[model samples]
Target chain A: MLQPLRDRVLVRPSEEEKQTSGGIVLPDTARKRPQEGEVLAVGAGRVLDTGLRVPPAVKVGDTVVYSKYAAMQVSSEGEDLLLLEEDAILAVRD
Target chain B: MLQPLRDRVLVRPSEEEKQTSGGIVLPDTARKRPQEGEVLAVGAGRVLDTGLRVPPAVKVGDTVVYSKYAAMQVSSEGEDLLLLEEDAILAVRD
Candidate 1:
């Protein structure tokens, strides 16, 4: 099991690519990197000045879409891993 | 100036794609989204239990590389924008 530190989060990218509403296959050259993924692990919430832990809104297994250029990539166990902070995440995909 | 909230960071992506060491043009389909960007703004640091504000390491104009699938995108002023937390950032490029 992977555990993030501080407000960091670990995410696994979805293997599929996003298609435009028109069904045009946005080539990898045209489409930005896939910015959607599944949450694998999350860090403990950050402690506020008031000594309260503000839990993150995201959890493991949650599907999310983030900025293509907003996370750090790490190689673990021969797999690509992403580490992000909670605020780096935008919204959860339903 | 844009200001992120609660460890959030604002980044402007570099419009260039990453080429493999062999110079293979990883098509948009073959390559991931360009996860490299320049830091535009950062949020105030999270308050630690020790009552210290741990400032973020990223600052405006600093070039960075992040995870493509780890940030949220927002449309601001007709430009595509990305919002991410500091932890989502990987390494700063010189």
Candidate 2:
């Protein structure tokens, strides 16, 4: 159990979307990174330079949209996980 | 003049790095997305479920590390720009 500290969040990246909106699976070289995931853990929150603590936007179990390049890959309990900054998260979906 | 609102942030994505860290020029097919940028605009802080206002993480003119996949490309005044969520920002680099 890796607990992120200071604006860091742990995400379980969703499976890559092989098919496009048109139902076509792109080639391996042309495949884009996945942009969605499940929220697993979050840091206390981002501390502003002014010393204000901004509350985290998403909570555990929240499905979120995240940038593909923002994640740092790590292995936790044999599961592939992504360590992301709060800033990289786009939005929470339902 | 595009003004982002509510957890959105605007960035001037830097030019793609044509050379590798080792100074080798990667071909277009092998090149990765750029992960850094200059802050151009910031949204008002995200509103919490508690109705609290979380302060923004970055300001205009700040250089930040960002996720490559998190940005939506747009043309602003003929310059390419990235519209990103505040969560996609990794860190402020001075």
Candidate 3:
């Protein structure tokens, strides 16, 4: 039940997919860092100078791709969570 | 004159200050990563489900603080630039 403020999003980072899209296996150190997560919650949105609130693009349960190292890691009740700005989300998985 | 797309912004990262606000000097390795930058340009904002463009929260020439590694660094014309989404900007300096 942890909610973020403003345009921040709460995400549960998925386990890294060790294989590449082309099915190439890499060594532990050579593996690319995971950049995908599942949206758990979203904030009300960012406030603009014009007094308007910008709506978020992603919703709960959506699978999203984010930039590497662009999020904050927080632990709550033994659960691993990621807090990031909405803009960190680069794309939505179909 | 590189313009970012969507909600991205172009920023010029300032040189890292070796001294703290209280005049404490730290070694290079112990120094905190610089998180501040000056906005150089902004995109046309992010699109929403309603097909409306959300106004940006920060404008050109504003000093902003972003996450340690939330932005993409691109070098243009011998100038180091950072491309970050508006949401990655955590706060504006007074």
Number of the top-ranking candidate, with TM-score as the measure? 2
Best by DockQ: 1
- What is the C-alpha local distance difference test score of each model? 0.66, 0.68, 0.68
Q: Specify the poorest-scoring 10-residue window by lDDT in model 2 chain B.
A: B17-26
Screening candidate 3 with a backbone cut-off below 3 angstroms (N, C-alpha, C), the clashing residue pairs are none
Instruction: Tell me how far the alpha carbon of residue A44 in candidate 3 is from the true structure, in angstroms, after superposition.
Output: 10
| Model 1 agreement with the true structure over B1-94: per-residue lDDT tens digits | 3345657777876766323313543345323644788887777766567656689988889999876554555444565566776777888998
**Model 1 chain A lDDT-worst window of ten:** A17-26
Candidate ranking (DockQ, best to worst): 1, 2, 3
Q: Name the runs in model 1 displaced over 4 angstroms.
A: A1-94, B17-34
> What digit string (tens of lDDT, one per residue) describes model 3 on residues A20-50?
3234324332224447879988877886655
Task: Output candidate 2 Cα RMSD.
Answer: 10.9
Residues A1-94, model 1: lDDT tens digits: 5679878889876675223313443444222433667898899977777787867767899887554445677767776777887766655655
Error of 1 at B32 (Å): 8.9
Q: What is the lDDT of residue B92 in candidate 1?
A: 93
What are the models' TM-scores?
0.44, 0.48, 0.46
lDDT (Cα) of model 1: 0.66
Q: In model 2, where do residues sit more than 4 Å from their true spots? A: A17-34, B1-6, B9-94
